[model samples]
Target: MSKPVYLGKLTLFWCSSCKVPVLDGKCACGQKTEKMTITPPGDIRPAFPYDVNRINEVSRKQFGADMIRPDEIVLYNKAPYEDRMEEIICGGVILGTIRFETEKTEWVLMPRIEGARRICNTKTFTPEKMKSGELKNLIVLNDDAVPYVAEGTSVLVPGIYDVSDNISAEDEVIIITKKGEVVAAGRAKMSSEEMRNEPRGKAAKLRWKGTPADETSPEYRDDAESGFFSAPRTWDDVIAANRNILDTFERRSIDFIRNTAGNMDKRVTCSYSGGKDSLVTLCLTNKALDDFDILFSDTGLEFDETLENVRKVAEIYGKPFRTTSAGNAFWEGWEINGPPSVDNRWCNKMCKLTPITALIEDNYAENGCLTFIGQRKYESLARAKSERVWRSQAVPNQIGAAPIQDWTALHVWLYIFREKLPYNPLYEKGFDRIGCWLCPAASLADFMNLRITHPAYMAGLDEKLRPYAEDKGNPEEWIRYGFWRFGKLPPFMQHIAEAKGIITGNPAADAPAEKTGE
Candidate 1:
């Protein structure tokens, strides 16, 4: 059984003219925009150089060349998957998904029709080139099979007119027409030689189909090259495109902050998390307030970059900075809890909330403080429905307010660029969200990333968790595949783990708890 997917606000619009996402229906270039309906909980972000290079390398593995060009602006929207799956968007269309597979331990690109069309250009690239080993993974389908494959039918051995040698059973392949228009992507059921010699059977199983949702394929009917959707777009262009809207939003947020804080006669402070959202909140707080304090939670797991950003932000603003200590609380709890899972996050409260709440109480003893924190609605379902100003049951006496509640990820990034704020540098390094280096909520993709950037840090964490994992399941597999994240193992996960004998005993029980933040 599979879980139902929750789609958040479908208000994301893209401007083809400027090749950038816009907050409004109209673009600064005076072009009408198209709606980009992406995966749920749409906290989309820009694909920085690190991320783009990763995508290009993955594309090169499956397809012969790079599908993305330097001039284009790409967006990444995280989808609900066991490890990691990011829907990649460019030129106002969701070109495909880039997923991290645990068994393979590599990034794979599952291109949409638009994405396939981008690479399978008949002009510069041809079937002759593939046979000569200059290019690879090409499968030319007979004309009769083209309509069937386009209609979502598997390609049979008899349907294959030509095939490339690089393909083996279960390898990702591009199914194209005799004239070279890509209609579907598939996993080879047999090797290229088997497809050529075998009498009959499925040559490839259709994985993803195209074209009831995108443009009509008349242009590619004659085997022409794709436009590649390449257009130069800098962050400056995005800022300029949304200039009017950014100014409007800044003014509104500042006003809301001033009015909301004025109504409350309590001690004031802005929550600084050293992440992008909090950085933007701090900037807004400075504009709205005459005098306010800055509060930071020094959760022992924080990264060196985060700690540095927190200090720099305080020093730059010349505000009274206060840090609270959790003081070995996480380690003490983890000793009993083992490893916290997505379903059971007891570490959040023990490591962060207790210390933060205690700090708030000690400072504002009489009346609780009104803390302006960075909370965006697009980040999750609970936040989308949450009030702009509210009280946290966990934290006594502190009235919480979100100044950037309605802002999207793009809005935050563009604002950061406009203000020239000294934000954390990790965003450019391919990290979507920054906080604890070993956050339990993080996926295997996030963990694997540490191998290159923080091998020592990951080694230290693996040493601690390996002992705990050996007691519950296959030690190495458990940690490697991120099975420790599932207290109540998801059905799909259980099937995979059980087949491999990774989970030899009962799965861990889920002890539910609310997640404050990363």
Candidate 2:
């Protein structure tokens, strides 16, 4: 499954005439306005459970330790559609974003400027921080070269004053004036030591420059204070505020289920995965239909908690529970497929789709079955544009329907809570979504949480990947860093490996056979 990529927050520009949030400086009435930070009433959810430490680590590594408050709540607002973009909101304002890039890396997208000056940006700190030696990745400009380094201009080697000795080429850096004012945030063209010594060359390629504006304006002050932290304190609070919307959603979904079932000539069943989405679907399905079966594809790689939840939910609903097993299929196919990566997910086919197809064929081959799934548009682009009910070419004899296709993660969570349903314990244990214990699609943050919650599972994964790493001429660190999860190393990982002078070999060459727990 493709993960949601958080691009960043929507830039809020206030129209003075309109007195409301506008997408840009121009209002519908053609009135130009200034940027303002206004905390809008909305849901503030964790990007991931263990993301707090990761966010702090990024802040500390980029700026300095104790720069951002440890107690500050870090939340995310997802972008519309399946773009995989989320705006990182804090204190009721968009601070930055945790973006899942196409390269299989999550990037922090911070604002370039608060108003007229560059105060801070994600991965790049302010010039004051650089002068205080708080920011290690920095390029100090020469005294005579301040005028030339505008918002759009590049920093040249000839005008360089000082550079951090630890700075590497391609590192994100803050270019600052001698007086400690930030000029721009950019990528270093050359290493810090090399840039300082080189007579003539580009030092840093600017991404965003400091704009000329009135920093002392009241708009700027208001913008600074606006943040997402001022939103609802808890999920319950959020749900309570949107109770009417939830009611409408529940009514619509129940109606959809009834209408779809009324039109279908086959038996009704719900595809339950024991995850939040699926659990919601199961609940809605029960509300819509008097009698329906629950079809669960037990991939065998599922967490024990998930398996137990599935049984519990089925028993609670008094529904006929049927399960299909992909027993050891994922492990057996590992030798041929290597490891499942974000780009290559053969495991899903072997463990999920294949078993689901067989289960349908054996049970409902004559008339087929209409399966209500817990698919949401927020999950991916493909699902976003998907029809409310459709037949998949991949899975024959099965018609799929998603009642909560328009719902968001927040909505699903709220509904689950409102219904007083017993959700999977994995979510309480810091898992946002439940799936295979060692799913490669999971973020590094998720993996860290998994390590803390299920050390044995992680250790088992490490053991499995160890031989593959060794066979591929990669160190144990390859498995340790979760490099084995990707079929191809992302640019970020490639940079780290290259900096360490580690040459990674192809795992496809002389691949080892799958071990039978020997």
Candidate 3:
């Protein structure tokens, strides 16, 4: 006879896909399904309820309230008695209360969220001066009761009697008995059904938490290299350095005007991409030099919204904006060679550099003119090498002045705040950098957020990229794996939904994956 299956307290019930808990008897997947609602076993300790307002305050303190929703709250709850572990059964928008001890000041549990397995402790989980011995005594693992687990072993496929409905591709989860005892901590290797069918390979990547509630930092990289660090310890230093940079820029600007102001004819132009840096450069130049031209080269792949923003800003400044379309030539080049990758960056050089060079050649003057740019030293390692004043080797006898070279991100934000400058709305929404929509340099989360926030933009990207990925092969994997599976919806979308008390039906609509053709 087959071994008796372990059915802990977790009850499987058919529910409406709309609300995973309210028994609707049918799932949107068209298959009958059952979900496990996490409930603690007898006398299981519970996390105390956290105030929603306190969460908002903490979020504001961590990440300013400039763009954050004022109503959003993030509360903390602790897993009840050390013996039983917490499991996140469902993943999506959820609202539930938790119970905890009132006297415990050091530990607060996050709101009871389905699929929000405790990934890491963020300062509040541990007791003051808590030790490992104290923690081991507090919690218990119901591994033996699960029957799917063996001591000193990895989580294999056959032992997984049941899987959580909300398992994501790379989400962290708790392995436990349906009775709510912690077995192991691990990352999900496959989705629920996939794990059941594919009875091979690893299922959950296991982890060991030595302390019951140790508030240790999560294992992740520093925010600086990841382009996620909006503020750093050296921000003040960077800000102080900006004074010298601004002075250098002002002096160079005057010199460029004095020398090239008369010589500048049709050839001299500010290359405008409608980016914050480029816009600042063109506006400054337009103010300083009369009849200076704004050169905008369209590569055919810019976002429609971005293009509109460009036009709106240009119209506002009342500057003469000249446009050069380079799509046909770029497509021709792609047909011959191939799509550009991050390492190649040939698309930028070929499509942008070639057209601008052609424009300069067509309008070359006897006296070489200057190109004022809003290039900043803090943009990347490449820009770090740039100076306040330097002559471009690409354009002989033409000088480039990067007035904002030494500015920090805070300075940029401050400048925009103080002057009420027009900027790409994308920046306000948390996109650190903006360029081609399909660029691979974008993080998976970034791509996911873009798709969820801007479905129309994603649709356009899909139409443009489908033929290309198909031509190269493994189109499905490219779409499913590279695009959808690992991608994440932007955090703000959920925040917005939470604030409005509405659920986002199509969270990944704006994803580049959705935009790209499979």
lDDT winner: 1
* Cα lDDT for residue 91, candidate 2: 41
Off by more than 4 A, model 3:
1-268, 286-291, 395-397, 453-457, 460-475, 480-518
Worst 10 residues of 2 by lDDT: 114-123
RMSD of 3: 20.1
The C-alpha lDDT values of all candidates are 0.80, 0.66, 0.44
- Write one digit per residue (lDDT tens) for candidate 2, span 14-96: 34443433334555466675664532222234444445565556545654442234444345555532223455554434554
As a TM-score, model 3 comes out at 0.47
TM values, all candidates: 0.90, 0.69, 0.47
Give the Cα error of residue 89 in candidate 3, in Å. 30
Error of 2 at 490 (Å): 8.1
lDDT of 2: 0.66
Candidate 3 local lDDT, residue 413: 44
lDDT of 1 by residue, 1-518 (tens): 35635534555788867778887887878888877788777777788888989988888878777878887788888887877899998877888899988677788888877787777755545768778865578788887878888899998888889998868887778888766667788678899889989999998888787642222367544223234554667888888888877898899999999999999998889999999999999999999997999999988888888888898889999988878988787777777666667666777888888899889888887988999999998877788788999988889988899999988787898899999999898887778989887776787788889877888997887787687667754758676676777677777667768766775322333433333233
C-alpha root-mean-square deviation, candidate 1:
3.6
